[model samples]
Target: MVTTAGSAPTPGTILHLREQGFRVVATDIDPAAPGLYLADRGHLVPRGDSEAFLPRMRALCESEGAVAIVPLVDEELLPVGELDGDGLSVMLPRPGFVASCLDKYVLMRELSAAGIGIPRTWSASDPPPADVVADDASGGFVVKPRSGRGSRGVQLVGALAEVPAAVAASGYRADELIVQERVTGPEFTVSVVVWRDGGVQAVVPKEVLLKRGVTKYAVTRHHAEVERTCRAVQSALRADGPFNVQLCLDAEGRPRVFEINPRFSSTAALTVAAGVDEVAGLLRQAVTDGPRLTDTWREGVTMVRRWTDEFISEEEFASHGLAPAPTVPLVARGDDPAPRPRSTDPASGVAVRAR
Candidate 1:
């Protein structure tokens, strides 16, 4: 299996899978994306929006004899979801599920109607319902792009009147924005792995001690309420692969979720540490016809992330094609393999025989 993206999860996954005897093909649009450095072979490819993207990606797979493609970023998910599979095994939810998750508005509506606790949300084009557009600013709201990543273009509005300008300033049209009541409570980012049969394999809800979109500091935790709520949402979405959910405890301490990500979370290393190894599940699934659904995991594990610097001299950068970045300290580093192409048995569906 070959995975794309050089983000947090991708690097750890590359390391983890490599340790399991899978060759890593690291790819990213940014040449300096640190994960690329750890790949058995790395490709600096075009952005997902480029017309050349899919064609080039398929070409990469065929050229490298890669039978599976794992995507770790949002921008690449939809396009990767469209892959016809051919002889390649790709683990993506259906396109409709991908669409619903990507569009925050739709996702919230669906979840809200499913009896999931979601922040009261408003759309730009539609005048707020009576409860949302009240003159009083009793419930503070946050406005953000309809489809966005991270905390970018997010605006806190004291009252509904402030939403319009915030939406415009956010570089999104009014209809392309969503304003929702701001949540206040300790937050948790829960990741769940599901099989194609709609069976949930595992759920890891980690308490976020600190974060910058990606988890910076976390501890493996098990809140019965949070785990229950996350699984409810997981079933509601019919999520068929690895996906993450963002939830914050409400004033009442209920785990009210606000977002769902249809890929592996940045804390893949943490999950691996916590005994819920997604890369392992994916690697096995990629090579096999199904996934194992037994639940066995370690809880109450802790993780703290620190930066690393992979400094290289100018000549080294030019000669070895180096990048100035470090592996996140929590991510494990494995011995780099000398093999040019990793082996996978298509019919048998095994990467390397369990020896």
Candidate 2:
């Protein structure tokens, strides 16, 4: 049995695991979590601060005869690592490795030292020596939080003078921030699933088509640079579990490491759609007792954001005495037919809008 904690298990992942013939138990601190509704057995626990939660989790695991614990959220990763599983395995990297990857600055430094190509970066707290900053900033620069995720505290600033405010808004002292010389290029994400026995199961590369406030909105598979970069970073990090590495292709099309996520990423859904079952890989690694590597690639897959409406119906609007759907006037008129009101009904279903 595999147990998941924190956020509810993603439906895609849960369904994939079930198809792979594994029983999964999912838990979250919020009982109303949508993911819980689809789980085999969904339960709630006290929020992150509660000490009693670990015992509850342990009891659940014991009762269910759980063979492994899999943490689905960032907050639960470390805590789950620290929990005594009574010899039951937990599907996660070592605690130290997880911690190192959580901090962007540390991960960058390690990757750079390990001979991985990375952009030149400086800590906001250290601010680089005046001479070093001057040398590296020959181009422009980006200021971001040292440990932030989702581009929450990332800013593209043209001059060093803009650094202080960006760092301040990042919720970190100057020393706890990282300022990197902006590497101009197209960005890509490589999602790979690795097993504990030093094997990479799948590599899916995505070209970032649209970024909405740092979150990827549109993406498609077309480039092999992501695979090369993934291989380099995976070797550099020496990570033994599922992880993602973000890279930027420089002017010459060379990939440079930007950051690393040491767990399943928000973009994992895209890879799954591209025919890489990461959850299945995790389950295989957990239940099997041998070294395994998957070198599969699914190219030419595309994913785009969709929008749709729900609740209000066209009939209901007509019944409410609203104007019928507008029609284009066929003959010349003093004024054009009033435009149809935009759909105000709340959207519920997925809408696959073109990028």
Candidate 3:
């Protein structure tokens, strides 16, 4: 089972899991999520933060006979992590680690204390002393929500003086945000898969070429420093599941970690494409003893985001109790616009035009 089917990267992840011969049960708050229709089955559930979300998810797993869960969104991680027990297997880092990762300030403090390379960070309310601010005028500071993922509420300012206005414009309380010296250089999103006994399974470092909230264009690359920094993070956090490290290299080629996403990022598919199927391997380990992973993975594999359309006939749409699309025929019933190959799934009676 995977939650947040509506996310951009989920449908491809679902298809990849299915290709691995797993019966995927996708769930989302919205019924129209494309992954829902592509999965073996799907269910609509309450929002991840709602009190009712866990109960519905528990019941849905039992009803669907799902043995494991992979939460794709941050909001659902804590609640879903609690579901890990003898009966159901949940893929998440330890509760403490997850908690720390969710709060940027706490995460940086802890990692910094552990001697990991971290940007100069402080709670928004406790602004850094004027002398401590980097003298490089071109190198700005970042003001972001203390407990959120991605660049949604992050703001960049040329100096500490602009932080006040940025926070005020962001509509977040001073204490609810964090200020950090912005690190610059080549950025990489590294995936570190750890085993139950804290063994580092595989570290795949991807050089990010483009990003919009999530990575849109990335290529698998081998950077010893980046991989070394990620392993150091695993050693510090001791996360027993998969987590992604977002970092940047300074002028000296040292990796400075900026954020840690406790769950698989949208780039999980890219990891799979590069050769290590982290999701499938983790699921195997969670259910039973799994194989050991090696450090060798093909590099230079790239992933580019593209738009894909999934078409559903009016009849199949109505079967799910949803409003049907316009009844007008795409072309006149007997008129053949062009020759196109068509396929049908007998079980669901959904026909598709393949191009």
Candidate 4:
């Protein structure tokens, strides 16, 4: 297995994979990235240099006898797809399938062509006719870069007069921008793992918690609605591999497909916690016959951001040939007393302190 940025959130998926008994070789362009410290073997190469990076990855797979390559980052997906692993399998959908999922315009066209309900959309250059825009009951509309991800360059414009400036400032050519009728309702994410044989292996759905400025966050599981939308999206995409389909529950309580991510998404961690292990499924599909789809997800499970701080003691630091002096005091006199140090139990690495 290969992953980039080996940090929290993203690395959470890789760590889950490791717990499933798969040996992981983590690679990133930054050798000193914190995630490297967690992997069996961590490698670094020049940044944005996939051309030079591919050969090294091929060598690592050959040496380690790796069965598949799973990309955690978006940029790595296409390049890894292009690599000829020389029969060493890379666990991704067909190249065309991956591309179709990645390209928003293509995904929309395909979903629409398949009779899936989606927001009314058009190219920014050819803004909908004034009469049509006016006649639509949906008031505000969203304009965004057709190929962008992470909600980058996305705006909700309430009027047609706001579109030209929004498009101009979006850093996309007129043709690359798409204007869509903004669907008003709760947003949900449906994560589906598909096999090459056109089967839906697992479907996990999550409800999003949106704040003012932060990109939307998946905070809870909504099983009934999630299941409904997941089935709808799976049938629509005809997905072939691991993909994420996002949808909004429109005012009428109907799901409308919004965007599709071709690679693993941030929500993978939540699905794993919900007992739908996508990484394990990907590996299983790559190595053996695909596993039968099941509804094993645990609902009402919640995951919140957690922060852990570690303090290296003087003796421990010296044992590793580091300076013994403290860089920062562990406790200050007037400050709240520090808690007792907990045992460094390797299992889960979550320390338990006595009262």
- Relative to the true structure, how large is the alpha-carbon lDDT of every model? 0.71, 0.62, 0.80, 0.63
* Residue 142 in candidate 2, Cα distance off native in Å: 2.7
- Leading candidate by TM-score: 3
Instruction: Give candidate 2 misplaced runs (Cα > 4 Å).
Output: 1-9, 48-53, 83-87, 129-132, 135-139, 213-225, 289-293, 305-355
Candidates arranged by lDDT, highest first: 3, 1, 4, 2
Model 3 ranges off by over 4 Å: 134-137, 311-317, 321-355
> On a 0 to 100 scale, what is the lDDT of residue 17 in model 1?
79
TM-score of candidate 2 on Cα atoms, chains taken together: 0.75
Query: TM-score for all predictions?
Result: 0.83, 0.75, 0.88, 0.79
Model 2, CA-based lDDT: 0.62
TM-score rank order: 3, 1, 4, 2
Model 4 is weakest, by summed lDDT over 10 consecutive residues, at 346-355
Tell me which residue pairs clash in candidate 4: none
Clashes of each: 0, 6, 0, 0
User: lDDT tens digits, residues 1-355, model 4?
Assistant: 5666434454565566677777776655433344444445555533223355555566656665777887766656676776535666666666776777666777788888887777877788895857656666456788887775566678888877788888888777989888887887887777787766777777777777663222245654655655666666666655567787777878878788888777666677778778877878777767766565565787776656444433546664333321122122233222213321111211211111100
